[model samples]
Target: MIPYQKALAALACAAGLLTGNTAAAAPDAYPQQPVRLIVPYAPGGGTDSMARALARKLSEIWRQKVIVENRPGASESIAASAVARAPADGYTLLFASDSTFQLNPLLYNHLSYDPDKDLVPITRFAASPFALFVNADTPVKTFQDFLSYARQHKGKTFYGSYGVSNSTNLGLSWLSKQFDLDMVHIPFAGQGPAMIALLGGEIQILFGNIIPSSIGFIDQGKVRVLVVSGEQRLPNAPDVPTFRELGHDNLDTGYTLGLAAPAGVDPAIQRQIAEAVKQAVADPELIKYAAETLSIRLFAEPSGQYRDFIADSRRILQQRIEAAGIGKLDQ
Candidate 1:
């Protein structure tokens, strides 16, 4: 007869294969081992900033290492699906964006895992408004100029996005419908490539986050921001008008980022992690990094309200998708 330990190992392997729940530490003790915090994008972006901050604080508080793993692709759905399939033991968490949880559902035809059923929100961390940027040499200087150029040039113009059906893409789609613009969408593998295309003048404009690359280009006078996608102008860029201030409320959209564990995580564990995140985002260094460097506003809505926020965002995204006639991508 096989030894008891060998038999248990065989059973665990079978369970993993059957349910797609990879091996995980038992939940009774909550994280008795190292925890993985998965980010859907590469390093040096806003998501990485928030994930690293929470990982550091969670590690210190829990006395267990919280590793930040980058799994960038599919507009962050790759990492979200992986986390959704992980064992519900609070050891594997997704540092997900609104694109991962809200937009992907309406964008993709068939997802590997049900986001609502597979992942549970822990805590919301931030909301990042996008900037409407154009090349410095472009004749347009302000949002009004952009509108006039689009109306005059129509289909001759092109815009770039990190991916189709992403937050930026959806926001641009809403803008096109509202303003009757005939611009074309040019997609890139990621934000870095999109930024490169923008600099090369392959695309006329890009609606993207105010990250290091965008900020560097803006400071270098290579590209300029015409508007921001928040209710009010950003403190750093007070001259740039918001969509709301410009009387285009539908274009006033920003993406949200947060941490989530696979559904069925113990309520107590979820609350424990949420409480920890609440403390982490409050760190002076983290707050400074989010605001001064990344230009992202930090958010800390309670878990229940966070879920409501997700639902509301999803509803709005669905309406935009339908109104714009954006088709789902084949998986």
Candidate 2:
């Protein structure tokens, strides 16, 4: 029995109140509280250092606390799965290498979290070449020397990796299959243990990063790098040739570090944080720190471009694994 004009007025008032309450409950902001950046490696590694640097810069930009937590194990699956299950509020992030997304899927028969569905790429900040290294006690001094030695030793030789079915181990597996080189794979909990095994003469070869681990050993003449895996040779190890130069084209992909958030995050929020990361990489102080301390170059790729790059990498890895007949891990 109410007039039309009065009913329309009441409906508008109700809509206004609902909008106000919704805005109050959830601010249309990117980051409203402390952000947690999870790293899938032990503290003091290159990825950890980069994550900390990014955390500091992001905190300054957002004026909010940013925490870096390490959950290293299971070939980075532990930390990655934890982040994947986190709320999609843009507060929890994962800083990991290409291996976490690219290789882990092909390695493990079943994964706790789906890399493609549970996590989305945010951006990539840095990349560096990995090297084929041997302990100083080992008889090999060059790639040729190591290849000859591996062929001669056959199944008796041992190789250590940062983790099972990781990029480091997969590289060895691909090489072993291609050249008919038989070397046992010894997977460690982390890089520290693998480095110790290499240095202690428990393992003869290691496919590892250039920073924090091999640099000190190479400087002290405790480890010999036979080939560097990248497009070009490293400045510090200019004498070392790339895997491509050595006629192994498939091993040319290097290590990459990037940030990812749980899937279903607000697209606007993802862009906001991704821009913050791009700006952070351009900071002069962070550049100096990465070059001097990490012995790696700093680079940045936006979320869209990084996603494409990772897709290409994943395709290549899958093809290589299948071609090599590397079966999936039961665990």
Candidate 3:
């Protein structure tokens, strides 16, 4: 029999060769099977619409089934956690928003998965600017006018946000703190309900996305947009002023939707998914759909850059949540 040391050395050499062969045999052909794109919201919302639009475009590009599954609940926590637990094979992805990877972690006391540790950013698909609107009959015509009226009304100035810890709520809280106003916040199930409450005179102001479904109301003189929260004016509402121009430079909160996969996915597969996403967003049909339906600007940043962006956004949102003193949920 060979000596123990010689036998161990021989075993190590064989193991190394096997490892090299396995690495060389790894397939780079991504999406060999159907890809599941998870949208952490209800089926009819903006997030779902965008996810379906992306899935269609990706299907055309890959010539494979790109399925969109809606898992809506717990402020998008359910869907996010599902994706985090999915296999790290790049076949499953999450179409996430600020609520999932940013706000939920800061606002909840317990989470099934840590976004920073469980998910890897792939790309940012679009950014939807928040619009502050009032009923068309309201005397407030501009941001300045609204501020003046809010001050005079004292606690009577009511603003409707989607929920307590949603982007709309956080943004409205920041604006209220900055302007030294005591506006009462009314939370609704979603932006649709919040806008409905505003239209029915149950609330005076609402912060929401500018979807095409609501454009008719604006054109019909039912809702008047006072200002939009963004660094630049929106193309759909060019005349609307930005919060920065109104002297609230720090009130630039908008919704950014992106794709993320469970961490430890093969880097090559991640790159393939990111490239597919970029190509899908660039397609003329997809661009037209985004422009006409969502009024969202196509802002696609690559996976590496998107990781940095998510990190920065998480920090900013955490600071806001703490400053606003939003109560934590018990998970």
Q: What is the TM-score of each predicted model, taking all chains together? A: 0.85, 0.87, 0.82
Candidate 1 wrong stretches, greater than 4 Å? 1-29
The Cα local distance difference test for each model comes to 0.81, 0.82, 0.81
lDDT tens digits, residue span 1-331, model 1: 9999999999999997787665443333556799999888777655576678778888987889999998877777788889998988889999878877798888899887688898998888788888898988789899999989888989877888766757878888778877899789986545667777888989988887776767899899999999998777776677888888878786787788888989998887898788778887777887777776667877577789889988998897888899988888865
RMSD of each: 5.6, 4.4, 5.3
Tens-digit lDDT track of model 2 for 75-183:
8888899999999988999987877788888888998888999999899888877778898887898888988999999997899876876778878888888888878
Q: Indicate the residue-level lDDT of 226 in model 1.
A: 96
* lDDT by residue for model 3 (191-243), tens: 66677788898888988877765677899888998898887887788898888
lDDT for position 49 in model 3: 80
Q: Determine the C-alpha RMSD for candidate 1 after optimal superposition of all C-alphas.
A: 5.6
- If ranked by lDDT, best first, what sequence of candidates would result? 2, 1, 3
Worst 10 residues of 2 by lDDT: 21-30
Roughly what TM-score does model 3 have, to 2 decimal places? 0.82
Clashes of 2: 0
Candidate 3 clashes between residue pairs 3 or more apart in a chain or in different chains? none
